[model samples]
Target: MASFKEEVYEHISAVYQTAADEIKNGLSLIKEVWPLIFLLFLALAVLIWFAKPAPPDKVLMATGTGGSYKVLGEKYKAYFEKRGIDLKLVETHGSKENLQHLIDRKDPIQAAFVQGGMIAVDNLSGVQSLGSVDYEPVWIFYRKNTFNEGIHVSDRDIAKLRINIGPIGSGTHAQAVSILKQNHLTPTAPNLLSMNNADAVNAIEQGEIDAVFLVDGYESPNVQRLIKNPNIRLVTFSRADAYTRLLPYFEELGVPMGGFDLGKNIPDHPIQLISTTTNLLIDDRLHPAIQVLFLEAAKEINGAKSYFSKAGEFPVYMNTEAPLSNEAKFFYEKGTPTLMKYLPFWLAEFLERMFFLLLPFAAFAYPIIKSIPSYRTNLAKKQINSIYKDLDKFEQNTIQTFDPNRRGEYIEVLNDMERRVLASKAAKLATADCYSLRNNIEFIRNALEKQVIYKGR
Candidate 1:
């Protein structure tokens, strides 16, 4: 005999009550899964803690001073500075010294400019080449008297050759020996001079030296003297192509007629010469970020046309003594990292390394990451269903225990279970479940009242 308004209110109250209990049950299940969440969070923290150290903030390089290596190294330093890195450039005796520094792993040097042909591919182990940056032409200037005055020294008269190749422990010196060796000179080739470009030029000008071998480009200041002085003649290789074939690092290139001066028409025609490229060498352990920067700098500085190469001809993809590093290969294949194109260098580098870490985590933890909701729902449902089963067994006990004393104990136990079910509602429970647990509580109360009325007497 309830009014329509009262009935509607009662229905709404029941619905809200059911929803509250279902949610509380769900929360109890979630509480059971707390241990899983705690462990997962701990693992994530460890991963972040042990992430690879930030890309090196700086690096040291070995290069030749007062030459293209020094000049180009300066340009590279500038480029690195813009990207928040510092380059420590150390000047050394040319390619040969550079190679020694790289081989000595204990040294702090990370990179250097080494001329090709100085070291054989077999000898290179822990280092790698980015690529040849530019062609290092072999400029041989000799006294005109050797050939013009009929004073040419025969093959065996190398003792009378009186040549200055370059100083010992230098790229030009190595190239000089290589060239002489190809001509069948022994390791201790006689009359081999050890002098730098300046002294070599002075000696040639004074007729103190018969010939001078310079491994550099037309940009060399000494080469200018050879070009301008009519008393000196460039020694052209008659079998340049054959030399190139014998030496993997050698290339048969020509110094174009009038290349130095169109007015004087220096060579009068193309003169054949054997040359090697100046390759940038890197330690195998150098940071990959720095490697990419070196390549980018080389492309910018050596990609232009020079006396020996056309525009975009340098930073050659050709192989060198040391195998190319993986970073160099990647740059050659993919140009630049996709992230680097948009983000700042520091940010991009950090994110790139992080992505590598996250990639593995995402792959290996796919199941772990996915089981969150599954475990949550399972725990929630388990809690909800467990309470219902306990109630069922208690209800059966009440039906079976008909003795007054036993029924009184059953009622007490039933009351205690209802109190526990209501207490569980204090926890954070799943909201979707709409079981208030009130009906079950009411059933227990009614059963207890029946026991008192039917059996208490």
Candidate 2:
């Protein structure tokens, strides 16, 4: 007769074999759900790719001119350099040249400081304006006699005088040419000279030039000097209403005399001036992150309290050459960008990009995550049900196999199987199952002992 230990070892081996078979069967069933598994992996990959690191290297900025933009650009370049961004400063004639550079494929300029009234999108293509930075008032500084005297000249009289409108490629030149023509002055008859704003101002001071037109910011040093000058006078646009009505590109502004200095009492009365705003232009294809960064920079740079402007008066988006970019539009309507203002620039850019990429997966992923626990529970129940099948088979066979010699071996094997299954401790099985299994094992053990003693008798 076999020992109890030897018998129990065989039964325990069989139970483990059965458990392996059930595990294989479960895997086969799950194989049918390959499509869902594949989708889960795909979603994971997309999340990783979208949220993956953004460019950590360098950012590019475009700067133009010898004026305020150049000054502001220099400051930003220095600031960003310390933060590790590589700044690219480009020199152009003025705002008009800057806009053309952005639109031109040959030029790689990403952004520009574009003066107002210089762009006609009807002619140019593939460029957009972020928003206006500040105003460039059209300064019509003239010789002493031109405005002080009646200077009544018909279209015929305008043809007789000498005028230095602006440099050929400048934004001032574009608007000056239009206004002069509207007033019935021909370009050739006035002996129009193409001179820069500084040179024109100098000539007006010396009486070398009859009239000079400047379309530049009020904070410009040349403008300040002209404002304080008693000999030279700014040409007052008495027909401010007519100018605004006819020139849709222009807005009427008042240069309060002595506005520069209330103590000095410069101009006793206000001087009517024609003004237009300078816009921050970008290529239509420029990255959205760049657009957001620039708007953030402009908010701080343009709106500061200065000699010419009231606080919060600049960086306006209402009138622009091109429509505001989506990022810029969001900023204007909403109070402030939580992510951009609070987070690092590259980090904010990453979050913005990730939002767009993850939108499709959210609906599917949320439900899967919620149902995970129930799926795991079903798996546990299935494993316990497999153990129950083996238990039922052993119960049916125990009664039929009733030989005296083999009885001890059979009882020992059944006892071992019961011990293993009970040790598995499946939560799905009731507490009563432990009592029933223990009783059945004891009954088999007692019966086998009784048969052995009967055979000996």
Candidate 3:
């Protein structure tokens, strides 16, 4: 018999009442779990504080003034630039200077290409290795006219000749000193000269120097230029095995006949050379993400086949004077991280940090989450008990007063108490207790009504 407007109004009222009840319940639930919520936020804040910050946007690497090291650095720079990072190449004299830069705590250099045998493994403290990238052959080029044809080059012959052993801080200089000392020759020999790669190459070409000791990759411009030069001759290490025995870091490499130029039959016979590994070293404090990026760049750029290396043969763990980095070890063991393979570098790094951050938090939060339900139930019970205490006081007052004239007022008070209890959010959770309370209120009301009837009679 209700009109449409009346029905609509009633429906709207019911909807509003339901919404209000839900909001009240939600607020009550939040109150019960507020401590847990606070704890979770605190834990998150701690994790974020301790988590490794995002990788630096700009990184500086030490490379040689001009040679394969600089070229390799340029390649690495290109790789990093594609991933939204700036890789600045700092020009150094060579491996010794590069190693010194890495060892200096105040230096901004984070990475460098260090040759094997330059530093003793036991001496390294602040630097670590990504891996060996390639072979740096010790190319001893001499003017053919200086040494008779078919005459084996001897240490005495090299000791007497004017030779450019590279600049003071170069790997060529270091190795040249070591090799000369092993041959009972001193670095202070008047014939030994210190010169840069270009100057040294020019000296040898113009016949200013008898020979030059170059420690560089086969693909290096200076090495290639010397290889193609008709007047210059590469000295074959006849005692290569003996040298490798004395210098354990040196490896024997064989260059097949006509390897440099088949058409001209350059080096017409097979040659034996002693070489050391080109190690990629980084500062111990470098960020792990950046370390991983270096490893990946090594894989992409240095993993290819070259005259001295097979495809996928490089970026291998070898001749590392310093301990291998954790990131490098992980890379060699597991390959690139799965997320990095598919995601953008920055996004992958963010997700990786988030994953590490959340993993421990999940472990920490599991027990707390599991206890929430029990906590919520206990909170409801506590609220119900407080209401019961109020009811008990009211009932005790009613019993003690025993006023029949005010029995109607007591009934009204009981009705108000019932309405408040039913409206309580806790009442819904402890439904049995709520029903029992309502029943008790009704009983009190009935008792009051009966008392009033008896008194009236």
Candidate 4:
């Protein structure tokens, strides 16, 4: 019986041998498939390089100094914060300044709430729209006692009075200038004062300015305060249809009687207002994922039913001041991406990028992976063939020189070659070739023995 220690050593030796064999096979396989491995890595590197970068953790958006735009910006900021993103809001005069910020590449503002009709669409190039978010009506409020009672007010009449057409570089100012020009009135007239929404509201409330032209939503504090004040009256643009025709970007909005306050019958009459949409514009170079996030935020914040908008009616492709972004177009066509519905924002984005990267990589790597076994097999055959060539050379030398004096040395060389063949890793893969080599060695050894015996005789 084998001793216990000897048996234990034998077991350890067998385990070690198995592990070494596995390592050798792994290395051999890697060597044979090295080119395929290199190609796969190269393909992966190219895909990663071309892939869209991850959505930025911090972004800057331009809102208005005050009014609904600033309010909307706060809502969007809260939405972004929930997704682990920082949305910094920069307050400007209004849409005109916001559009300028978006167009200037050096400006840190990546997105803004731009009012339609503020500028010509042809002049905007570096900005794209995530679509219009809400209605910003051209609210014309005047002191009830300023104009003659029960008389219709004309654009020319308003231009001659002390009127606040909003600050320079504001959407209200742009619209006011356009309206005044259409009426053949001078917008540069001294009576067309430039004041911001709050100051203009205050000036009109104090009966200092005869009237104020504001472009804002009904929810704006300035518009609301003026609406509640019995002293100020909201203008009903009787020529609203003509204005829409003259200003192609303008839309006509109707407010029924008591639209402002049904309890108090605030307006006391149905009103026709000329309005424009608030477009969510972004830098054309903004990341696609971030654009998608903005669109989603628009849906959540602006899609709700409001005084002027029906539920899910906004965030639509209406009154687009600039071309719709690719992401926004996709969103309108298909809603939010499926991944974003269930997963966290960052994780969903990561998986989406990886999916796109791996899709092409898998197509490239499949054939190479499938051929690895064949490549490794071919390598094994080549190694066995090399040993066969050495055997053939030895046989030729033996037959030509007839080295009877060094017969022992020739036999020793044959034994060494056989030993090497049996020990070779390649021999395991080409078992048939290894067996054939052993048979050839035996036949050569027998011939050497016979020749030596015959020479001695």
Candidate 5:
């Protein structure tokens, strides 16, 4: 016998070898099933790609003139870069054109800055709003004294003269027409001229037009420039509260006297303007990821106080004609998706997509895994039972036949069964199954030996 230490080492080595063999066999089984695994994941990938698909690498945004939306577009471009996506800003005339771009099938526009009250939810069924971002205050700049040069006049007197109500396909134009119509001054009444912003500015400066209408923020470069000019007077409504009631979407805002330039005392008195919000709207066709991305970007850029809004007062779900986007609604309800809060954007998106896929995948795969052992064991049982059936037939034949030659044949069949049983045990039948085969073989041998079949029947 080997020494105790040597014997202990041998036992440990044997155990290790057995473990290694088992591990090798497991790997071999996995290798054999690789195609199945590949097909499963491939199917899952297809489902996820189709169902909760990842957003494209690029998106399109529609922004309007006067450097207001241009600044917002640039901010979104930088914001999307951190998430490894590109934001392409397409310039348009104004809100009406922006909405036109968003709703058009040929246009790849995903998001836009649209004015409130322009679209009714019933009319523009394909578009959705994220939230109202900021005030696009309807600014009416005109030659202050042109109505009665060297004399005094009133609002109606100024209204009778020609005015630039903005180009036809513009947000300013839409609101201007509506407001003018409210005052019963139709844009088509020949007193209103449809001119672009630059043209409108020129028209007013040169006395070609009495007034120019613009829908923009108080801080808009054009608004600021016009505020500083002596000839161009900002339109102030003393009856702002009454106008707000007349147009529900309009907010009554007071522009303090000389707010633009305290030193110059530009206004000389407070100006009240009726303003409507500019909403970030998305077409129903845009991906949800881009929708959420735009919402987040809008919050950071537009949520701060301008001359009108308080801090965190913007990007609000203002009562509107268009319905809100799903992602925007969720963002308002739940803040942010939980996974996205901790992980990088792309990774979080990937994992979120996979979670949706894997839930269904797991449901599909569970039954197949659960049935595997039963299927294999039944196959092995059939092999053993086949030999058992042969044994039963041999014994019956012996009883019916009296020939000695046939009896020798019966013994030979038993020998063949014994060999088959030993081979099955060696091949990897379960311990209990192998023992059952051996016991059955022994029982048959006893039958043969005990003259269950004899030369003299």
Candidate 6:
């Protein structure tokens, strides 16, 4: 049987062998999974490389009830189709129904022009604003005789008159009711005429109704022509300030005389109007591509100079149930693609997709790639430290006793440490350290072989 010291040495050697084998086995397993791991890495690369889907060949949109939404929807549909996107127009029952349809996940409605206040917080759930297209001022076209009462009409007179409220679920209906309710008029049981703005106007012209209410931007040519009628007059809310105070989202706007046409002098006097915003409501989970498409379209549609809104005011993001997605928020804050600004529409959209794909990788590649070298260096450093402790123990034993039998055993340990340290090849330590230790091992070997007792050997 081997001596005690030899037994210890053999045990240490066995431990070293087992550890080395385990390391090799671990490395082998790592190599096996490396392909799948690389695939995972490459998947992220692919996402960053081609993340954006191609813009749809056809775009879908919604218009308010009556002619405005239909006319505008048709016009935009043609515009987008000219740019290679076929714009599909879906008629909705005006702003409230349009917003409800947008919130319904089952509905394929990607975008809709909704009267802003038509959507309450509960109704706005799961919907985001792409921006508003135009302001729809609450226009009260009452007969000149009914226009008496100086902007503050009494509830009794309003109740007695035949009021043409808009269609059920239309924003116009909601606005008319809200305005009427504020003045203590009860239309719930009153004889109500359910019709769109155009029909209401015709009804009034035909003597079927006494008054009609419409809420739309002043830029509407139809509205321009209606106001020009000598028989019908635009009702100015003398107390517009009070209505604005009652409705936080309402803005008191003025339709200046000759504002529509300076040469024509359309309005003889400035018409005071109170209006609510309109929104391009979309689903919360709407695809980023679709969201971008709507926003970009909105930028073109709503940014025009209108009587009620200036450029960049319609797509307001606040107070929506479906908050704007991060990508949409980013684009809104930073503005749309430069190509969308300068290039033709089709080319700009394609480049925008490519840019979305490449940007993340362009942002994150360097740091992750550089970590491999750093990890290997740390592993080597730990291995070097482990070997150094065993070397120090052997060195202390050598100083305590110089017995011949123990000297050879200690030399073997020194040799073992030296070989293991070289195997580790820890990059943190200088190469000079390994060579110097080798020289010490050589001196120990020489002294053990010759049985020479040099001082401090």
Q: Is candidate 2 or candidate 3 better by lDDT?
A: 3
For model 2, residues 362-422, the per-residue Cα lDDT tens digits are 7767777665455555554554566557666765675555566676577777777666657
lDDT of every predicted structure (CA atoms):
0.76, 0.68, 0.88, 0.86, 0.77, 0.68
Residue-wise lDDT of candidate 6 within 7-27, one digit each (tens)? 999999999999999999778
TM-score of every candidate relative to the true structure: 0.76, 0.66, 0.85, 0.88, 0.82, 0.63
lDDT of 1 at 397: 63
Model 4, span 1-457: residue lDDT tens:
9999999999999999999999998886777678879988998899889987778899999998779998889999999999999999998888888888988889889999888986464567788889999999998888999787677554445666789998888888898888888888888998889988898898888888999999998788888899889998877888999999988888899899888789998677788899998889999999898999999898999999998889999799887457898999889999999999999988999999889889988998898899877777787777778878988999887787776788899899899988988877567777897888889888888888888433542
- Candidate with the larger lDDT of 1 and 2: 1
Go through the candidates in order and give the C-alpha RMSD of each one to the true structure.
Answer: 8.3, 11.3, 5.1, 4.5, 5.0, 13.4
Point to the candidate with the largest TM-score.
4
User: Order of candidates by TM-score, top first?
Assistant: 4, 3, 5, 1, 2, 6
Best by lDDT: 3
- What digit string (tens of lDDT, one per residue) describes model 5 on residues 281-334? 888888887787777777788877777889888788884778888888899988
Query: Which sections of candidate 4 miss by over 4 Å?
Result: 1-32, 119-123, 152-156, 397-402, 449-457
| Number of colliding residue pairs in each model | 8, 3, 0, 0, 0, 4
Model 3 RMSD in Å is: 5.1
Candidate 3 Cα lDDT to native: 0.88
lDDT of candidate 5 at residue 226, scale 0 to 100: 78
Query: Lowest summed-lDDT stretch of 10 residues in model 5?
Result: 148-157
lDDT score for candidate 2 against the true structure:
0.68
